[model samples]
Every structure is written in structure tokens, then in C-alpha cells.
Target: MEKITHISVELRDWIVNTMKTGASPEAIANAMIKKGFDPIFAYRTLLKLVNNTPVEVLAREQQPYIYEIPEIGQKGNIIATSDRDIKVLMRVEKPFILYLENLLSEEECDELIALSKNRLKPSRVVDTATGEIKTVPGRTSSGTYYRLSETPLVATIEKRIEELTNFPIENGEGLQVLHYKVGEEYKPHFDYYPASKINENTGGQRIATVLIYLNDVPQGGETIFPKAGVSITPKKGAAAFFHYGNSKGQVDRMSLHSSIPVLKGEKWVATKWLRQSEILERS
Candidate 1:
């Protein structure tokens, strides 16, 4: 017997269940190693299960970033930008999550909320199977999108984002303004286009998401990653950034996230999704 490297379906389910209950990846790996599995195999297996990608696909999609992000500063909290210094509040590795502070000023946040108030409409999501926008059951909110550099404020924000991520402006989508009231929520979902539903007109695959919090919710409204066992509370002028796309074009399942329901005050967010190629601004 050449040491069974294959993870059985039962074992895979157990691994996913354990992760959902808040077990760290390292702990999970240790347990599997004790059960007679290779360390490399154990690590990869956990990643594949958590990401919901096939084992073979996961192995092949372990590719490098197409563009590099500049180094984090000495304390690992400072990110150098052309005009502003973004402070990192926290970081997570498996799904590549970052909690950033002071990415926007209070004045900027208020102005954005004011600008989007009159333009808001019911939020819609892409229908994975059809590639069309539809109002789904899980998401209950309203939103609007600003064309790239549409206003002086929008342009300035976009420029700072470009400097921070090192992703080209041409590859970025419009800034989406979203509003959520008490009892509203967006269910867990991936930011990247599904492997089976890739649409060229939609600008290839979405490589990353940068979300700026416009206002703080008094009680609820947290950006949560169920599989990663992470929840980040909303704070005005703060932001969250995560990347899911790899050179092999496989999406990271650990990037699946959602907005918990607003319990007290409303929540507002401005989101920018970066794609692999240039997407012309229509409006």
C-alpha cells in the first residue's frame, strides 16, 4: 500500500464541517497528519475543500499573482500610496483578507453617501447560470454604480485605489454604492466569475474586490467569511480588500463572504471590483 493520498468523500465533508465550526487550517492539518496523511497532501486537501474547488483543479490553479502588490511597511501596518498612507488593521492568509483603516476621510464618506442617495435602486446580482443581472432572494438592499472617474471625488478615490493595489485603473470596474437598512443582508457569495460562467463582455474574471465603508452600523452589519471564521465590523472611513483570482483562473472559495443584517442603523458601502482586463465605462 503506497500510503493512500486520496481524500475520501466522507473525509472531505468532515474537513469542511470542521472549518465551518471555526477550526483553524493549521489545527485541521495537524489532525489529518496524525491520521496518517502526508503534510503537503493534508494542507492542499483543506484548501481545496474550503475553496469548494476540485482537487485536480485546485492543484493546477495554485498559480502566482499576475501583478505584484508593493511591500507592506516596517510594522506591516503601513501601505505606501501616492497621496495617502493606508493603515492595516488586520490580515488573514488563507483567503487573503485585509482590514484597512483611514482609506477614506469622514468628509469623503459623507459626500459619497449624499451623492448616491437619490440614485439608489434595488440591488441586483449576476445570475451565475445565465450571466444576467437579477434580484435574488438572499440579497435585500439598494445600490447604484458610479462610472470610473465620474466625479472629482470618484476620480480621486479611484486614483488612490490604483496606487494602493498596483492594479491598473483600466482593469477596474465602476464604483458601486450600496445601501442596506435594518433586516437587510447580502448572503455569502464569491466575487469572481464562476469557472463555468465566464463572460468576456463582463471583462473576463473579477480578480479582486475593494470595499470602502461609508458609515458605521450601530449594532450589526459585519462583512463575514463563514469558511474562514472571520467577521469584520463596519467602521466609517475603513475598508476591506481581498483577492480571489490566480493565474490559473481558479476562484478562491475561501473568499466567499456576506453582509450580516443591519440590526440598528443603516449601512453604506462603496465597492470596486477589479477585473483581469480592461472594461470600458458605459455610463
Candidate 2:
């Protein structure tokens, strides 16, 4: 018979209990191996269990991302929201970037920054291995998030975004406002979560991002897409909309981007991450 490759609930509980009782992870893996578990499977399962993250066993194989024209990426030069007319500044098809101007007004931008400044906290990134949010060296920024339509300003912005993108507010993961000071930068990274960590209830996969610039930077603070050789300057009221995922369960690697260090003035931006399905919590 093949070695045990599946972990039962009882076995998973046993591993957790043993780990809390001072048993090393290696010892647990070795025990599982001795009990006829595949060596690799034993080690992998033990690691996830120790980290307190789900040990997701995926049967799906990796497939190339199929490119499809998203509604927001269509050949439109203008998006008419209920309160504003946003002009398409530029477009890049390879990675699906639709740069826009006037996504927010001058007053709106200032208010968002004012509201977020007081609530700023050290930013955190999701640990790929454990699927937990933690502060790391790669990302150096301060940020805050607001619930969907929590305030009048946020409600107005979210509604405008819904009108522009044709995606419901329920699919948005709330609006996150980030601030970067001189020398603080977020290294190159993708916005989407790891495949195994995508929670269906929270909205399956992160499909796109609407990054709105809130303040003008004297220098640097450009959003760089290294693979695509693209750089977007920070202009107040302008935004970048990049679609990276599709219904075919594919994520575009070319959408990888980063916020380079600010050389002069501070940088402020609000990011709205969209999901493939409605986020249950927000819905």
C-alpha cells in the first residue's frame, strides 16, 4: 500500500497538541515518516501545522493565465462616474494598466489624506508561508484601512469606483491608504495572494488594483513595473488600474510592481483591491 499522504482531523489535532507540549517539528515529522507517511508529505504537513496555517492540499495543476479584456480595460478614453468624469491618461495592454486622471478631486484627495494620517500604523505584509500578516523589512510604509462606506467620503469614493470599474462595492476589500516618507519603499511584489491562501468567502482571488495618488511627490515615489519597463509618476488625483487575474484562475506575473523610495516630499496613496467574487464580510 502507498504511504499515508492524507492527514485526518484527529492526526492534525495530535500534531498541534504535541507541538504545544514542547516537541520539535522535526521530531514530529520523523514520527510521521516512521508511521508510514511519505517523507515529503510528512515534512510539509508538519511545517504548516506548526505555523498554525491551513495545510491546503490542492489537486489543481498550474495553468497559463488566459488574457481576456476586462470591462474596465476596454478602449474607452473616459469613465463617467456619478460625480466626476475621469480621463484615461494612458494604457498598457501587456499587463493591462489603465492609467487615469481625475479619479478623485483635489478636495477629496486632501480629505482622504487628512482622515488617514491620524490612524496610520506600521504597514504589514502577508507571510506567504503562514498566510498571516506581519511586519517585514521589504515593505516600509505606514497605512490605514476603512470599512466599505464607513464614512461619507469613503462611501462617495467607493461608489465612484464601482461606477468606474463596473464591479460592486461588495467585491472590494475596503480602501487602504498608505503613506511613504523619504527613504521608505516597498520592494517589488505582486498584489495577489498566494494561490493556496485565497479565501473564497473573502472574495476568491484578488483580480485588480486601483491605486489612487493623493499627493504630488517632488521626486521619486514612482510606481515601477520592472518587468514591463513602466514607471508611473505620482500625480494628485491620478490613479493606476491594473488587472492581473482572470476567470481562468491565472495571475499575471508581469503585474509585479513596487513603490520606489521617495527622494523628496512624502507620498500618499489609496489602494482599492478588487476580488473575483463578492467579499462575504463586506457584502
CA shift of 179, model 2, Å: 0.5
lDDT of 1 by residue, 1-283 (tens): 3444776433454355445433466776776676677878888877877788775433433444353232322336788777778899998876887889999999999999999999999998765433446676678899999888899999999998888887788889999999999999987776776554555665788878999999989999999999899999999999999887776665667777889999998999999998877775343
lDDT for predicted candidate 1 compared with the true structure: 0.78
Please, what are the lDDT tens digits per residue for candidate 2 over residues 79-156?
A: 788888899989998798998999999999999999998999999876543444677676789999999888999999
Please report the TM-score between candidate 1 and the true structure.
0.74
Q: After superposition, how far is residue 72 of candidate 2 from its true place, in Å?
A: 1.1
The list of candidate 2 runs beyond 4 A from truth reads 1-63
TM-score of each: 0.74, 0.79
Least accurate stretch of 10 residues (summed lDDT) in model 2? 56-65
Q: Highest TM-score: which candidate?
A: 2
